[model samples]
Target: MEKCSGTTKATSKKRNASSTEASLPDCKKLKSKDGGKTSSNKVQNKEKTKMEKVSSKKKHKFLGSTEVSQSSKHASKKKIQDGWLEVTKNDKGQLLFKDFPQFQPNMSPKEVLQAGSFGGTYFRPIYSSVTKQHCEDEWKELPEDWLKGLNVPTQVASSTYRDRVNTYKVKCGGSLEMWESSGWIVTQDPYGWFQWYCRFYQGRRTKDDERQIGRWAKCAGVKGRWRNNLITKVVRSGCGFDNPTVSPVVRQTLQHWGYRLTKEDYKEGAKRVKPK
Candidate 1:
């Protein structure tokens, strides 16, 4: 009976050990499965974050492209109109020509006049012309030695003489103030009169005249005559007063020269010109 009881105790211990060993594998498997699930979740979150960043970058690029397109369109429209020139003064109170693509910095007033001449414009002297009578008397009386010292041509010297005599007869005083206020003084044309004829009358005729005709002319023949007269006036006006085109190259050059055309200006120009 004692041996039988000991055998029964041993059997019970073996069964309990076997049950614990089987349950240990299940506990380990549960731990491994929980770790795998945690790792998978982390990978998925990282992928989602990457996708969001990519999407944000694409949105920004699209917005940038859109803004550039709109700006270019505005510039194109503004560049086609007359009287769109923007003039401003510099720190020295000297007129720094704005909206003039042909003008550049460091150019002397004379040089500017010379260059602008090609566009049917020339710079006129601030002073008024002397009369022929005064030029003969006052200029001829100057001492021969003094005239030689002046080193100017006889014709110019004579003109100066006449100018002094007629100065009183001139309506406006020869001064910068008068020139600015009246807008009468101008520069010489560089390309000569024939070039002016081609540009103002020949080239700009149909397009510009058609538009002007709509506004000013009452009939076809009248409009044609008016257009011809208008071209003649433009050719005579010369540079600084001439209507000029603003090209893309000119716009970039102006920007490089520290002139920033604002978006608002572009928009306003676009509204005014309505370029095709």
Candidate 2:
């Protein structure tokens, strides 16, 4: 079951298939104290790098299979053009961010969504102050099949984090209150990090790109603190890469960040982490 504080508290209870829509809190309700440049504390820690020590580890299956879509025509039309980079407004007509990344992200937004990250709650539409619906049209640009089976216009509170939708069937996250208090919430990406990531992946460059990418790097990059722990503690425990039981929480969290943890990732991390 998913466990988070604040608006998510009511959602902690396990939901049945026949369950009716429950009351949800306002998505805008939140808190904070100190302000900072980075999105979350995940970037503040001195994490770690790709594996450098362990060797000959086995492959792990952390992601579900994504079969080719029958609606090939729609998928083909969404092709992004080369040498074309201009971020306009989102579906809501809000002026999008204007900036560029020094580098590209390692993964794609659709891949993360299909792989089952954020408990299928990441893209759930929260109330949009502008058009009363945020970025709903953007989903149209994606493969119609990829957006299947998600809770659209998700109840702002309790229903936002459905554990069953997650690949690991476990819940791991802080509440909107926790994120707001940490100064992680940005108005541009009202739903938070993944929303920003989705736009970024679509080439919606923004000033926030550098900071967001920095946070991602600190979370999964070579020097990522989370990656370090995964290599030193979880992987070293002999649970192997495929063992979700090894660090289910961390694994799920990484999935949200566009990183599908694989045995190869474990191998590279092991190479970087092995002792002298």
Candidate 3:
């Protein structure tokens, strides 16, 4: 569903999820036929603040009902403070943790940023609601290789939210206020889930890991509601797995969660849908 090219390129140092050390292909602007109305009403695009726009028009529920675990414990401050970041990947394109198999994210943080997510403002300066501290350059804590080739101002930490920076060219998630109000902003990664993910990918284990992984599962796991919902829509639309016009908003949401719907995943979801 995400077909447009991004502004920056980043390569993985570890063996790529593609079973080889392959660089991510440059995603150029994809040609489309449906005049951009690829999704049903569920994926309609409405011009709104980048953080406020929801993928679904009907009952746009975000971090609402699912209660977040109030986690005060976290990974050793010593290791994180010592500045250690190690990134690895499973050959299957899914980062699988043996202890947390339910948390299988295909994209690395580098891939996610390179794919153009979060309106290019995810790591921007912010006064955290959880930490109550003005945090700047916290993104620098991430692996430099992952942040390579990224424009810090416009691509990594833009003060302003630019929808054009997103590969989908559509806003698809809830506001930061919603995240904080929902009690999902843990102090360890006050910016949000993706921040936690970047650290987690680099061996920063935390007590908050389970809760964060559960959230990722709810959004992108095998039976993840958002993931499954988008798959069903794809099956209903009868589009190819990479159809850019189909549910761009939902695709963008999944992208932020570090999962992209693959052809194999689409076919598998179709079988389950057909049986129902």
Candidate 4:
């Protein structure tokens, strides 16, 4: 497995039975018309050549040099605006962005960190499969103010997930490998969507912006499907809009995506779900 950039960082556990089998075995030999030894040797040589190639490809696929991705040629050009990380929220807890009206995340990246998200393991030291590098201190890239009072051990880089560190104080297992394979984990943000959000918030727009925004739209936007799903659960359970006990997992998930479920959002999200 690729190093999990998020909650699913790769482990150094002992390999299973499969790791012991590195030798190329000659199972069966192709027979010539006369069943000659020379032809048999040639066939064995060909088989060994093919097996060696396969083994080499596997090695190359997993052990790619980190310098290529860590020191990436596709790095987003620096463009710090007047108020690069400035955030102005509407009175009702809605993010207002003039450039992209379609994208709306209720919480800024700062708020997400302050309120506790990612089980404090989002930025844990990780050997990233996407970057082929052991990335531990990447979280330092964020604005210092964002991490002011937060403890790096339990709230920023804890190796293990601590449910108590989350805003909801609920256990949420968001696998990095799964999202990475689904094409959401781009080379720009190996830690997945939230990392991308942080960079975007810091006023760095790259080729991955549109795609990242699209993901937010589907997960936490005005008519986002995940938002609608949470609303439906809240309504169906007969719980109040602010009830923490109702769908805590989804709430935590939204926070991880840089959103907070506000009363206004709950009210609007309610309209998307019917009585049943």
Clashes of 4: 0
The C-alpha local distance difference test score for the whole of candidate 4 amounts to 0.72
Deviating ranges (above 4 Å) for candidate 4: 1-85
lDDT of 4 by residue, 1-276 (tens): 344643243232323333434332333333355644456577779999999897666445433322222343223222222126456777876777666666778888889999998889988887767867776676877778889999988898888898999988998755877776766676667888888788677655556677789888888877777778788998899899778898899888888887777787788778768886
Off-target runs (Cα >4 Å) in candidate 1 are 1-37, 67-276
lDDT of 3 at 166: 89
* TM-score for each of the candidates: 0.14, 0.54, 0.68, 0.69
lDDT measured at residue 184 in model 2 versus the true structure, 0 to 100: 79
lDDT of each: 0.31, 0.54, 0.72, 0.72
Model 2 whole-model lDDT (C-alpha atoms): 0.54
Candidate 2 to truth, TM = 0.54
Tens-digit lDDT track of model 3 for 1-276: 133222222234232554442443222123245564333322323344333443332112311213323332232332443333334567667776665777888888889999898999998888887888887776776667777888889989888888888888988888877999999988767889998887677555657888889998888988898889888888888777778788999999999999999877777877777534
Off by over 4 Å in 3: 1-78, 81-91, 274-276
Write down the RMSD of candidate 4 (Cα, Å). Answer: 23.7
lDDT of 2 by residue, 1-29 (tens): 34446446555444532253333322212
